[model samples]
Target: MSEPNRFLALFDQVVDQTIAFAELVDRAGYAAVPVDTPALFLGTRVDKIAIGALVRHLLLAEAHWFEQVRDVSPGGVIPFPSNAAALEGIPDGAPLLETYRRSYAERRSQLEALTEADLTKEIVFAGRRYTVIGFLWTVLGHHSFHLGQIDLLMRQQGIEPPEYMEWPEDQRVLG
Candidate 1:
């Protein structure tokens, strides 16, 4: 396979891992836990922001990275409750899942359009330059890093994280 195809395949794998992690969080239930500080996990505090807000933030952040590298603007932030009181208005169930699905689709589409040359080309953002491939890897790494935090929060709440479904033995890339 060509280099771009390989990168795209890896990107898809990362997205799958992210979705799996999100599923764990969703299944763990969204209960209003006591908040001693502003940030709960990874500096994302539960003060004025609803848990849904954090979920949306993560989804939007991923989308933003993809859109930026693709040279397109995915306008507008997804509206979510800003506080515990607002949780009543935020649907804890299907709506959030739908939003995540849509965001994933957008990311996948943006990734599909990338060529090998596109991946290697340097893109400037926030006064810094990164190869498109570097940015994509960063996106994946960022998600993986936060997913661990979310998993930890779930465990702290006495919720077990979902079992990581097994890929084929031959397909296991990590030792």
Candidate 2:
């Protein structure tokens, strides 16, 4: 496979795996937790936000970065919320995960269509310029970091998280 295609496939796999993991969380009943339940925050107790708000934060961040890459200004992204009222519009449980998945599928079609040249096209955000590929790499890494946080959230709540994904032999892209 070509390098750009491989990167796109990896991105899709990451999204798919996240959706699967979230399904596990939903089935385990954590996703139904009250909006006011504390999120697993920085190894400190004082700065914690609601667990549902953490999910919303991840969704909004993904949408914002993807929109920036598409040269579209993000509108209506609520700032990370500290309380339940701030999370008013976002859904909980399966509905929230479905929204996360659908937003990516809709917004990322343009990204998935990019040629290698397009991947190298520059965009500026947060006062720094970077290629589309750079932004994608950032998104993948950011999702991974938050995935671990979700895992910890599960563990802290006395639920064993879903098993980690094993790369399938046929899908292996790296030697």
Candidate 3:
């Protein structure tokens, strides 16, 4: 019921939803599509990178966001490299899954160590200061936004998203 515990609970819910979304994406099956094709976005398609790459970027970005919150370096950015020959640097299939797993582990560990007092403290990143609680909420929102996009993409590909996935349950009590 304390502030920090509440924040941690919210964080856990967000991560659970993210994992569900990822599982849905995995079940949808990645098909060979041209990298230049439009990606699914809220029932519409927009010119963007392939779905696989987008998923990879989402996973990497989530990890990076967590790293920033924990005041650690996330190493190199994982966006698509411009050089066609550089694709080899990104492991395909299973290795990509491994990277995500490792990042999740680190994030969870950091989350476990957070205290309520920590939530109110301001942290500076890239010259911008944000309360720990605010940063955590931002990461959650980012993941939810991307998951919405993934759902649309799956529908476009004629794949049905998992039926069990739903919006994160609201825990607030109404007076």
TM-score of each: 0.66, 0.69, 0.61
Q: Which numbered prediction scores highest in TM-score against the true structure?
A: 2
Error of 3 at 109 (Å): 0.9
The lDDT values for all models are 0.56, 0.60, 0.55
Where is the poorest 10-residue window by lDDT in model 3?
Answer: 38-47
Q: After superposition, how far is residue 14 of candidate 3 from its true place, in Å?
A: 4.4
- Report residue 133 deviation for candidate 3 (angstroms): 0.7
Best by lDDT: 2
Q: What lDDT would candidate 2 get against the real structure? A: 0.60
lDDT of 1 by residue, 1-175 (tens): 6555665566565555545555655533544443545445433323233334446555667666676667632222222223334224546545665766787787788788886666777776555566887767766676666566556656666657665434212364532
> lDDT per residue, candidate 3, 1-175, as tens digits?
7655565566565555545555555532543343333333322112244445555655666666665555532232223223333233655455555666676778777876766566666765545566877767766676667666666666766667665334366556311
**Runs in model 3 with CA error above 4 Å?**
7-49, 72-94, 124-129, 164-175
Order by lDDT, highest first: 2, 1, 3
- Candidate 2, 24-56: lDDT as tens digits: 664445443333444434322123443344466
